[model samples]
Target: MTEGRKLRPEERILWGKVAKSTRALRARQDEVAEYEAEITAMLAAEEAALARPAPPQDVVSPPGNQLRAPRPAPSHQPLEKPVHRKLAKGRLSIEARIDLHGLFQDEAHDLLLDFLFRAHERGMRHVLVITGKGSSMGSEGVLRRTVPLWFSKPEFRFLISSYEWAARHHGGEGALYVRLSRPRRSL
Candidate 1:
């Protein structure tokens, strides 16, 4: 710790051990090779996995011809042009509607599913969902952004037949016109 003074005998031995234990770095290589080796290994693993064949499976045939349930409608269909126009021009009625203003994402999602399911059960053909375009903060609202995407989820696939933006007077970008799937009547 003194100016230009040599270290003590034990201090010199410790310094010697540290110096011998450490290896010199290729500074340029260290700077450039960061994560490159890791990424290459990951990609190589992926390629090798892809190259392997999948295991075989057993197939079982049905005993006889039997009635099967109807296939579900495709998810996330757009509102039909004729129907959209009818709603816009006031020819078709919106049988029900649910406003999602001031609600969190989870609440809005649950409310939407319940409303759609009930409407479908009641045989209602058309409905409206109003998720306000967002606050005046310039960014879109959370519900406004996620509501449409929810329609594509598995649970919503059978409930919603088609959906599209509503007319300006009906709330424009803030609202949606959703057509519900009809429930089957048992014989």
Candidate 2:
């Protein structure tokens, strides 16, 4: 193939085929180069991750302080009450109330915590928490189940003395009567 020379029709047809095939080959080579570059980036990332040092296992205290052993995780169960008797009929009354219906899990949890903490600070004895009977769907009432579990956490156990299903006049199975502890006198 001589540069700038006009070709015969048969030669031109052959040259066109060669040009088309070369373009396709170049396109394929570009695609392969992109793929290889991507693979190289991934390998570099993996090697960098592996070369990093592992985190230290021991916790170090600040200067002038001895390192204390890690405290055990709090138990899931609620603390046992000093006196286990149920409140006498008509004796306990609701001093405050919170309705958790239609609230998301996190919202309900935060609201419950704040309400209980404030009620405890105010020296409130009994409060009502209403978690509506859940949907008839297969999932059922999530809040109804979660509220009690939240109360069982150590943070709440110290503030909440006890809890029981409310009277029918209050909310029956859909609500609970939460008994609060007396406010702790600060030293």
What lDDT does each candidate get? 0.80, 0.72
Which stretches of model 1 miss by more than 4 angstroms?
Answer: 1-73
Q: Can you give the lDDT of residue 49 in candidate 1?
A: 55
lDDT by residue (1-187, candidate 2, tens digit) is 6556556656755765676565336759889788879977975875565456445467789989988967543333332343212332555456799999767899999999999999999999878899977643333577987788777566787888777777676677788878787887989
Q: Which candidate achieves the best TM-score against the true structure?
A: 1
Candidate 2: misplaced stretches above 4 Å? 1-91
Could you tell me every candidate's TM-score relative to the true structure? 0.62, 0.52
Poorest lDDT segment (10 consecutive residues) of candidate 2: 79-88
User: Model 2 — TM-score against the truth?
Assistant: 0.52
Deviation of model 1 at 33, angstroms: 25
